[model samples]
Target: MPMKGLIWFRTDLRLDDNPALLDAIDKCDEVAGIYIFSENQWNDHNESNVKLSFLIKNLEILEKSLSNLNIPLITLNTNSFKSLPKDLNNFSVTNNINQVFWNNEFGINESKRDDLSAQILNNSNIHVSRFDDQVIYEPGILRTGQGKPFSVFTPFKRRWIENFDMNFLEIRKPSALKKSISLNNESSKIQYSKIHKVDIDLWPAGEDAAAARLSNFLELKSRDYNQSRNSPILDGTSRISPYLALGILSPRRCILEGMKLNNFELTSGNKGICKWIDEIVWREFYRNIMHSFPKVSLNKPFQDYTDSIKWRHCDNELKAFYEGRTGFPIVDAGIRQMLTEGWMHNRLRMVVAMFFTKNMLHDWRLGEEFFMKNLIDGDFSSNNGGWQWSASTGTDAAPYFRIFNPITQSQNFDPNGDFIKKFIPELKDVSLKNIHQPKQDLFSSSDYPAPMLDLKTSRLRAIEAFKTAREFNNS
Candidate 1:
């Protein structure tokens, strides 16, 4: 009998550069794949339907790709993580698998589920192997001179550069199986309400599409990335984020491809290419943060003092913010874009998040959940890190006093209001000078609402709230 192996697919979906999948193929004569859909767990995590739909589409494409390699994908459905161990163990027994392999995922609940599953498999006399494929540096590998995880990004990045190895970017290509195996398991059906579905067609599914997008960006737009990335109106970004979030493309592949364009120099390269690489590193940094500080994965603030901060609750304002009727053109536009397309530009993400936590005095967790509930590119670590940073509640966060002024940010980034007008049609007729902060007359003539609150006063209020929380904590 051939040595049988099972590959458990999680966030690392693509076959290319997949260490766990490649390892399984190398070790066993015949390999099968399994993907378990934990609906209850996803609901508990506030996963967006848009993200779910994208994931299902990608899974279909991945299944087809795996089939070409003579690997059959077995889909399973379970309500939550608590049931995964039993399901996986039963599947392994029924399939008569000798070994199981998977890539590691970082999250408190995810880690727990994997640990239990590994224990169960070990007890069943089946070997389990986990690979670090999500990040270039395994979570605990990179540390400070003091033998601690670096809390700040600059020093962490410096060490990351210092410790950089060309071997880390090596891409793995799995060889085709010698013979095909028949599996009786059926693919799990995914159904979502019509209201929850977004037009995911905007993002084509598959590894080829992802690779094409990366190639196009590097060849055409990377030179201008640093210069125009902040402008929402311009196609200045790689737009490969959805692929990255879904694991249709790997970070190592992204870095390696980008470095090729920059003469294989990560630090001294085309400024735009280098900056884009920095952004990828930032993503890894957030993953490290989640691994080092698991409390963040559990909805706890990184800065303990932030827990004492009293957040205001206003249903009307919250609804307005959600519906893109907050009367702040830039913030509203960003929110509207996210609602419509299930994605938001990076710069706008920060601006709107800061507006929600500071100007609106809402809890950062609320904004974080809202983003996760809508964004197609929603990754827990990145979303949580961005939110906590905007709210000044995480390690290396912006100081509480550094609140962003929405109107000014709008003028600076979306200067001519092109991005604002694209999402908020009412502002199309408004003059460029008045579009960022439309006058009362313009609002009355058009359907646009006026500024919800005086900017200066709101900034002062948010500052006072932070100060009060810090003072109380000290007392």
Candidate 2:
């Protein structure tokens, strides 16, 4: 019997630089691809409608790409991860697949599903193979001097650079297989709702689009990225995040292209290029945090002491923040940007998250969940890491007392207040001096609300709460 293989496509939606897909092609006379449609799983993870829609579109393109390579794409529906293992095993057995391959996903639930699928497949005498394509170094590969997973990013980054090799960036594109795989794969349109208000056109689909975006960013804006990245109005940051989130682009390909511009140096050369690469490594570090410390994946704070912090719950405050009427122009602008674009500038994400968790004295989990539910480019690890960092509840978090004043941040990053005006049209008429914090008279005239809370009082309140939590933890 000719060897038949199955490739389980999860986050990895593209073929280029996909180890599992390439390995399946190399090993089997015939290959098929499988994608599981689990709406419940998506809901469990607080996945955004925009992201789901983007995923469906990408899968459609991926199916066509796989067809050209003589592989059939099969989509299976399961309620959740609990049922996925059996469904996948049945599909493998029914199709007489001798081997199954997939790239690793570091999330707790994903890891469990993959493990169960492997167990059931192995029992049925089907060979199972897994590869790591998400991170240059597998999640748990790099560790501290004591063989422990490094919890802090700076040390982890230092270790990552020390262990890095230039050859790790090399990627191969798989060619068309010798023979075609004939299978009854679903050719119907994916069932997805168009409820997301985000303009999907903002993000072009497919690997080609992703590669083009990266190329354009590197060619045009990368040199000035270090200086311009913090400015919300500047198109300095590479918006390849959505592509990376969906696996339409591989990190290896991104780093390789970046290195080509800077003499192939990872840590040295242009400051902007190096900084851009650091962001990629930060993604890898978060994956490591998820893999090594599973508690974070379970919604628990990495720093357990933080759990004692009493987070205030106020429906009016949450609603105001959500509707972008929080009266803090900079913070509201960030919220409105996410509401409209399904994306927010990196600087604003920090400012908004800090204001939510610290100034508002709300739970970080609330902000984190809201971000994931609205962001088109949301990755669980990155979003969670960012929220926890801002909340002072995660590894290498900002010091509890080091709260960012939204007004100061606004003045520093959005000095011209163009970003504030662009997203908050009610503030368009406000002078530059009052753009960051409109006067009461201006708010009354424009229908913008007054500042919800006194910044100084709220700052003191947050500090006191953290101190109380620390005392409780120590006691």
Candidate 3:
């Protein structure tokens, strides 16, 4: 009789170099995998339907992959972790499982779920093991000499590069979970009779899809990524973020491919390709931030003082901003792109975030939640960090006085009405310079909406708010 274990899969959907999966296979005998769809958690976090669609598609792909080893993926339809312990315990006992294993997640409800599950398993006399697979280095692993989390990205990124070793990326083949176990081991398959209707046109899932995307990015567009990642008018981006967000592609695999290209001492693409890896490292950084200050995922700002700042309420203008009727071509373009495609360019994310929080004098949290509702690539930490950074209310956020001029940003990045025209159809007939500020000349009134509010006036209002806060705090 082999020592049986239950491998509970969470964010880490792939088998390649997954820390928890590897650990369980190393220590346990027959390993049975379970992926539970917790609607309770998704509702609490406001996850988009696109996200669920991706999960189901990836889970299906994972099932096919698991079938290769004759292992069955048992999906459990549970509402919440409050009763998961009792539920999982009964199932494990019936299946004759001896251990439970899973990876760590750093969200509020996620932590609760893991804690409740662990406590339940502990009482049942079953050993439980969990691993940190999401981020390359845990939060505390890399800290300043005074034993504190660094707010700035520069010093942290430098240390990350210095500390990373080549051996970490070596392909790891995990121990087999009882080599001959078949899908027939489970008495029956868990069913989710009432799942949301999912259309996966936006984000495709699986390890193979992830790998192919990486190959396409590296082969075709990587050379120009450094220059073209910012331009919405051009599609020269490495759009592997959705896959990376879902863990269909492991960071180690991405780093290995980048390193292989970067080590090409003679190629010019190496430098830009390596720079792309730094963006991947930024994801790790934000994940670690959430890990250290779990309250962030609980909807708290990184800076405590920011909580006291009174954000303006301009429901009418904010609506204009979100609907792409702001009359600023660049800002409007980003907003429309998000509404239509459920994703925006990384550069545009920064710009539109700034326009809303800084120029419109609106709350960053509102924009953050809106993005979560719409963005296909929206992760809690990254989106929160992004919105906060733009609003000057987060760790390493821009200075309160420094605000992005929407017109200037459009002229600099878009230069033409190409990206703006794609989303804001009314601006299709407007000229390049007029498109940047269609409301100024009243040129696009026939089809497009007018400017919600003057930019300079809004910018001054934002400044005044910050100045008042500064004076009050000083007093």
Report RMSD for candidate 3.
Answer: 3.0
User: Tens-digit lDDT track for model 3 on 182-297?
Assistant: 34334334333333333356566788888888988888877677888778878778777777777788887887787677673222456668678878877778877777777788
Clashes of each: 0, 0, 0
Q: State model 3's lDDT.
A: 0.76
- Native RMSD of candidate 1 (Å): 1.3
lDDT of each: 0.90, 0.92, 0.76
Q: Which residue ranges in model 3 land beyond 4 Å of their true spot?
A: 174-199, 264-269, 439-445
Ranking by TM-score: 2, 1, 3
RMSD of each: 1.3, 1.2, 3.0
- The weakest ten consecutive residues by lDDT in model 1 span 190-199
When 1 and 3 are scored with TM-score, the better candidate is: 1
Candidate 1, clashing residue pairs?
none
**Residue 139 deviation, candidate 2, in Å?**
1.0
TM-score of each: 0.98, 0.98, 0.92
On a 0 to 100 scale, what is the lDDT of residue 412 in model 1?
92
Which ten contiguous residues of candidate 2 have the minimum total lDDT?
A: 185-194
